[model samples]
Target: MPTMKLGYLKVCVWLACVAIASVILYTVVMLSRRPLSLQTSRTAVFTGGHLRLWQPMDLHGIPLWDLLMLYMTQLDNPILKNATAQFNLTLPGTCGENFHAASQGLKNISSYPSHFQAFVLSMHFRDYSLLVGPADDEACPDGTQLLVAVKSQLVNFDRRQAIRETWGQKGLVRGVTVQTLFLLGKQGPGDGYPDLQALLQLERQKKRDLLLWDFQDTFYNRSLKDILFLRWLQGHCPSVEFVFLGDDDVFLRVDALVAYTGSLDAATQRGLFTGHVFQDTAPVHDSQHKYYVPESFYQGTYPPYVGGGGVLCSRAVATQLYKASCHLPLFPFNNIYLGICLRELGLVPQNHPGFRTFSAEAEGQEDLCAYKELILMDHRTPQDIIRLWRGLHDPALAC
Candidate 1:
């Protein structure tokens, strides 16, 4: 009897161990399967009529939730991501519809600037056709590696000439075949400008690199420039490897830009979007400010965006961005609008040390070594750009 009791007691102990193990496993499985609390204050914040997900670091130590969020980040509508990770729990649809609807209602407001008015009109009507452009075959010829498309003002002929004579010259640098083009919009007498079409035509005939569209060339219309250019790029330069889009006023270190792009790994090269990044910035409510954003127009912080002074991106990324832009409502600020499109693709703009969009401290502004180390710098005068380019190329100069 004692032997039999000992054997039964051992079996009971084994059964208890098995039950405990099963309970632990069940708890783990349930935790993993639990519905992600996207509604939680810690996970999401409603802004600009969209839910912005918490940064990945914010959710540290929560592996199961991270996994769930990562899955959501891969969804078709990708606006939920922050700077590092993406998570969208909202109903699947383009988030820009809300922005379009909101801006549509505000079109009748008399206080809005003409640029903002133009942007609102664009949301409903995208019929602004390309008045003049290069032949599709000639825009980005075969063997083109880098296409530098400068956003030039209709009046900045000197600036365009300076660029062509220096960094914007079309040729092979470090074996990278480079092509340069200028983007222009209409600026005729109706907008208080003399008819410079004859001069423009002469320049175009000589250079064969101007992409002109039939839209007003105003500050707010800059976003329209981006949209129109992307469409051109999609149709004309589809096979080009890389593109550098920037203001005409900026100076470029083409060799450095090429080297930097060449160093990117295959994955990064395929999705490269790097420059001076702006994050966590909000639109100003002050009407006097250049970047004023009325609450009725757009609400929330700007997404991570490269400064418009200079941005470098791969053709593939540019293509994807163009597609993403289609679903987004036009933002007055060109850089911020591109950033929104990046968010729509679940992409975060990578900040690089080379792109200095804003001018450095006054002391370093003319330093040759400082200029040599950067890929691009903004707010440079045409003469200054030419002088700097010559200085950098001088054999006697040592960094």
Candidate 2:
């Protein structure tokens, strides 16, 4: 009887072990398909109706419950996994809509200087060390200046020393003090140098404010949607002159662009969404093509927004556009969507004569040339940008 009991007990133990193993394996499988986890908070906060989602309808009329359920159901279903790891999305909206979104509630215009000119310099700062060798040859011209706001992820604390030593010294160069709006955002707040305030406060003034961006946010893929915080400029701070909207690597002919646009209608100077334009077919979601618009996010066609690289829109126009975009839904691609919105609102993107959207790859070719010839912008490497900036004004090296 004792032996029979022992045999039955062993069988039961074996079965129990198998059941536990199966449960473990099942959990592992479920975890592997975590596209929309319970911790999904990738949403746009409607802080005063700034459109963050690039859709035709506003957060107003769209069946809120249905959309929520759809999103939640997708999150719970572990079998269906569709997640994108990118931080930029091209939403469907015209330029006019984008302008309106930026221009709403622009209060107390009289408080700011009536001649309140703006230079929207779009900058991207991936590397600060790159700024070392590129000396100031084509400096900020007379009557106009630049404000450099940089977003970088370089982890070294010592890097700020170099940045401080270079930019902090107010006496480095004379005649034109380049007003720097330097903002360096990394993976974390503590990631950058703690003593960076010296460089942060060039000419005894700190320009850049708090900027923390999480790359994992689903809505993070859309750049235009993310920049909705720009609405803070309205009615709060109005002493802004010439806001530049370009990336870090972009070598800008600031002197020339300023000289030329300074003479034009300062209130209306904008970009041409400069690139190859295809009319009427509408933007589709072809991953292979340059003009692909994703199907899941954007349903219909896209209006023209300027190429994201280098766009220049004045504060007045920006405010006007923002006002117009108040009731509209979010547009994904800021450049193209802004273009489409502007077209609808009876505004046009004027092409710059010096702008070059593409570059020809060849041996011994300089990437950018912003000399007296006045090249507006160029997409080049840090090394190339340094070289181009240095060589372009050399007087001898004429391209």
**Candidate number achieving the greatest TM-score relative to the actual structure:** 1
Off by over 4 Å in 2: 1-178, 182-226, 235-237, 266-281, 287-292, 360-364, 367-374
Model 2 lDDT per residue over 156-237, tens place = 2233233333332221123333333222333334533344444433422332222323221121223332243234334323
TM-score of 2: 0.47
Q: What local distance difference test score does each model get?
A: 0.72, 0.39
* Model 1 collision count: 0
Model 1 ranges off by over 4 Å: 1-108, 358-365
Clashes of each: 0, 59
Model 1 agreement with the true structure over 1-399: per-residue lDDT tens digits: 999999999999999999988866654443332222333324333334553333343443232322233343333322322332333222123322322222233333456777666555554333467777777666777788899999997789999999999989887899988899899888988888888989888987888889888777888878778878887787676558999989999989999999998888999999899999989998797887888766546545677899949899999988899887664446678998898788768899999988876554453257788777789888888887888888888999887
What is the Cα-based lDDT of residue 338 in candidate 2?
Answer: 58
